[model samples]
Target: MRVLHIITGLKAGGAEQQLRQLLRHLPPEAECDVVTLTSPGLVADGLRADGVRVRHLGMSGNRDLRALPRLVRLIRAGGYDLVHTHLYRACLYGRIAARLAGVRAVVASEHSLNDAEMEGRRRTAGVRALYLLGERLGRVTVAVSPTVAEDLRAWGVPRSRIRVIPVGFDPALFRFDEVRRKTARNFYGLPEDAYVVGGVGRLIPGKRFEVLVRTLPHLPAGARLLLAGDGPEKEALWRTARELGVADRVVMTGERPYVPDPGDDAPGMPDLMSAMDVLAAPSAMETYGMAVVEALAAGLPVLYTAAPAVSDLPADAVPTAWHVPCSAEQYGRELLRLYAAHPGERTVPDVVQRNSIQNIARQTMDLYAAVLSDAPLEVRPR
Candidate 1:
């Protein structure tokens, strides 16, 4: 089976990373390639190194009308058996292009639903209309979480058309290592005895990373806040840290470079997680908490706020994850308690069995086969 994956851009984001992981585990019989609607960023090089073909559409802007025909021509020329799309813009354009190119099977994945998309009732009508149109064109719309699937149904997508597929991660990549942890702490200039609280995500308003900054001052003197990711809010977050008089305690590691090596057990996120005492995800909204799950895989306790990806999971699946209130004070209190508890690592064999890239890729390939056969897409309950 030949499949073409379409996405807005190959930037370092949850959806983009999920796609790369999925591609690495696809069945040998399945031939897959990727096409980015805009310029391929850091992920392009990694995908190429993995022997996956990547094409850039050079979409000028949101109103670039020429991109539609260009994508249609590319799809027709590629003769892919199916087209799978990720992100909003890619879903909108990919569905239309696949239809125009006479590709009967098209699947689009919905990764998130932010507040901006649904501020007022009337404002969402246009967005819902576009989504409904895409659902009509595509064979199926994959939701990364059950909450996301519910959101899709609320937006007028038929229940029959929505399939819930949780994003998967490689446990081997995030396995904890003591030596690497010490090295990583030294590399980042973090004191070995300091209590480290880490947050991994884009430094944006929606992520609510400022809450972590606010919580830092309330913690013990040696407590440090490490944020791993970057965005437009970097300068503002730094200013907030200074205003709060905790500038020296905050470390913002601008976008960590992702080096994808399936077999090589080298230091990356595993070392970072090992060095940290706990992971804090204070995002105001999260469709799926990829970082939270990865932290759990790394055997770290997590204090998160309304992470549907983690909350929706069965209690037995993630015992280490604690759902906390969004307030910084509450986060600080919980961190203190958790620090005192000094939670030990629990075996997360269930996480590896259910969320490994291999299992998710197999499930996805099954979905593709079902789509081709016009069979019902079974929603796997966790």
Candidate 2:
């Protein structure tokens, strides 16, 4: 079947990363294509390397209507069997374009939705109306977490139309390797004996990354902050580090791919995780903490403020995952405690396998089949 994936820009973030990872796991026989409505950065490059056809629509902004006809034309020409849309802009335009192109099966994912926010932006009445209007044109909507599912319901979407499908991680890729740990540290120019504190995500304000930077002052002399993604907040984070007098200790690896591109020199997510002594997620709110789960898969003890991926599971299954209040002092205290206690001989937790990408991929394929056949989702959410 020919499937076309549409997203708002191909920048490296949770939603974009999930799109690439899901496509990578799909069957080889299924023809797939990707179109970015705007900035086609590192992720676009990575997707193309994976042999996925990618296009940039060159959308000037949110108000650009000319791109709609172009997208419809491309969809019609591609003869796609399914059109899956991600992010807000893509959902609104791609759904309409897919319908215009005569595609019957359409899928949209609500990757970010919490009590107060959607897509990292504060929720508004106008946004909700627009989202609902576009949602009606699609057959089904996939929520990345139970919280998002509930939010969709609250947003007036029928419960029957929403299926909760948690973000997934590849367990095998994150298994801790001592050799890889050494190599990754060497590659990143990290000192062999430093106590590295890791945080992974787009360096956005919602993520509260500055909390980690502020915690640097409270940490021991050899402690370091290693951030794995990039966004508008990069320079601000550097400025924060400078003011805190720990700029040299803060290592910002701009926009590394979670699933490595085959020939790329930059270290992949797994290698970076292997180099961390502990993973700190200072985000005040999260829908489904993909990075926290990835850290658990790497056998790193995680201290997080809000992570549905860790919290939704039974406590026994995620012993390594600890919830902390959103504060630098708390994070610093937790870091010191973990340092003294000496956690993880690189032992992965049981929860890692629960949200395994293989299982998620199968569920996703089942979802696609259900939508295509116009059947109700018999979702087995893990």
Candidate 3:
């Protein structure tokens, strides 16, 4: 099969990361290519390094209709048997372009329970009309979690056209590694004895990073904060840290390299995950917390906001790892509790395997094949 994947950009995030993982596992006989509606990102660089063909359409914003023709040309030239897209920009343009190019199979994924990132304050009546138009053009849509599926249905998408498929994390890349733990800590300038409470995502308002910052003063001494990704909120977060008088204790390691999925076949990610004492993702909204699962795979406990999207994680998997009511004080209390318990010392490695990328990819490929088999979806009236 010749598959073409499309997205707004290749920047690091749950959808992009999961798409990259899925591509790495394509069967030997299949060919894969990717198109980014906007300029390619650091993650796309890794994709190109791994021999995947990636094209950047240079979209000048949401209204870049000029890129549509280029996209149409690429699809026609590539002769893709299937076109899979992620996020709103890609879904809107990719589906129409693939259809114009006469590709019979098209699939798109809804990576968030809310569409705020893609549809901002200009979410006027005209925007909704346009969105409904684009959505109606796509053949099938994949939701990363049931919450997302429910939200899509509520937004008028036909239930039959949607499929519930969870995102996958590579188990091998996330396993416990004592040697790597020391190395990663050294690389980050963290003391070997320090308790590291970290998160990996863009420092943005929607992520609720301030909640983590607010929780810092409550943590015991020797506890440090790490935000691995970067974004518009970098300066804001730094200012917040300074205002809170914990700037020196905070480590803002700007965006890092892409960590390939940790399935046995992938390399390096497991070592990186092992370096952390605990992973905290206090996002206000996340379709699927890929990093949370990655932390779980590394045998590290996770602290996250109580969103339905993250509720799928098993109970007793780690100490205070599941979703809880949002409160910086409460989050701090849970973080401290998890730190004291050292849950991984009691949990088995197999607990992480249940949500590995290998299994997720298999399920995704199966869903793709089913959608391609000409079986009509159980569509319902909106």
Candidate 4:
């Protein structure tokens, strides 16, 4: 089986990481290549180094009219038996291009929810029509979680065409390790006696790092905040921390020069999570909470903001986490309360197992086989 995986970009994000998992776990009999609608980044560069055929379409932004012909040409030239797309841009273009190129089958994997598309009749109407076209052209669609599957149904995607495939991470990379924790903390000059609360993300405004910073004052003086990321909002976040009078306790590591390979389950950074007393993910919006799961895998409890997008985590997993109200003051109080409980017993392992990558990959490969079995036989390219 020849499969082409299409994505908007190769940025280091949950969807990109999942795509890496897909490429690594695909059966050897299946030939896999990746196509990016924009310039590939660190993740794409890594994939190519590992011998995956990586193609860039050089499209800019959402309104790239020129991408269609280029996309069609690539799909036709590759003679792919299947085209699998990740995220919206890829899904929109890949399905259309696959059908235009007369590929045997087209499939899309929905990694997270996009609320902006569902906010109104205009976007909703356009999306519904697109999905209808996609449902006919793309033989199957995969939702990363049950909640995501239900969401697609509500948005008018045919229920018959959608299936739930849980996201996964390798357990080996996430095993608890104390020595590594100590090393990471010491290397970064984090106070050993202090309770460390940290978060990881693109440093975007929606992530609510300010909320976490606001929570710092409510906690004990020994508590400190560490943010691992970089974005347009970094300078402003730094300013906020300084204004809060906790600048001394704030450490922004900026973006690491190199992140973990997509195949790696654990982040490349010193397992700082293991050293952390707690992980705070107060994002006002997050679809799947991949970072929350990663922290749980590292045996650190998580605190996420109460949002519908974060509702996918199972109830059992809630015990290991704290969901705070969206308000910064209330969030701060809740975070401090948890910190006071210090090393509270929680089912960190179970939550991690539920989101492990190996199980996710196994289910994905099964979906591939199922989709292929039902797919029409491929015709020779004209």
Choose 1 or 2, whichever is better by lDDT.
2
Best by lDDT: 2
Q: Looking at candidate 1, what is the lDDT of residue 208?
A: 89
Better of 3 and 4 by TM-score: 3
TM-score of 3: 0.90
- Which 10 consecutive residues of model 1 have the lowest summed lDDT? 114-123
How high a TM-score does candidate 1 get? Answer: 0.92
RMSD list, candidates in order: 2.9, 1.5, 3.6, 5.0
Each prediction's whole-model lDDT (CA)? 0.82, 0.88, 0.74, 0.72
In angstroms, what RMSD does candidate 3 have relative to the true structure? Answer: 3.6
lDDT of 1: 0.82
Please list the residue runs of candidate 3 whose C-alpha ends up more than 4 Å from where it truly belongs after superposition: 115-125, 258-272, 307-309, 313-320, 342-351, 377-382
lDDT per residue for candidate 1 within 1-382, as digits (tens), equals 8999999888767788889889988988889989999858757767888899999999997679899999999999998999999988888899999999999899988886644553112326777787688779999888888888887777777888888888987888777777877987888888988899999987778788988999888898999998888788999999999999999998877655346355533335557777788999987678888888888877788899968767786787777788888889989999999878865764454564467888888879988998877787765432
Instruction: Give the Cα RMSD of candidate 2.
Output: 1.5
Worst 10 residues of 4 by lDDT: 114-123
- TM-score ranking from best candidate downward: 2, 1, 3, 4
TM-score of the candidate numbered 4? 0.87
Tens digit of lDDT per residue, candidate 3, span 1-382? 8889999888766577777788887676558898988757767977877789998888999887999999999999998888998887788898889889998688888775464534223445665666678887777788777777877887778888888767776677656878877877787777888888877887777787878888888987788887777788989988989998998778876655546433422223455567668878887667667777777777676778844434754554454366655679878988888878754472434655756677877866776676678677653322
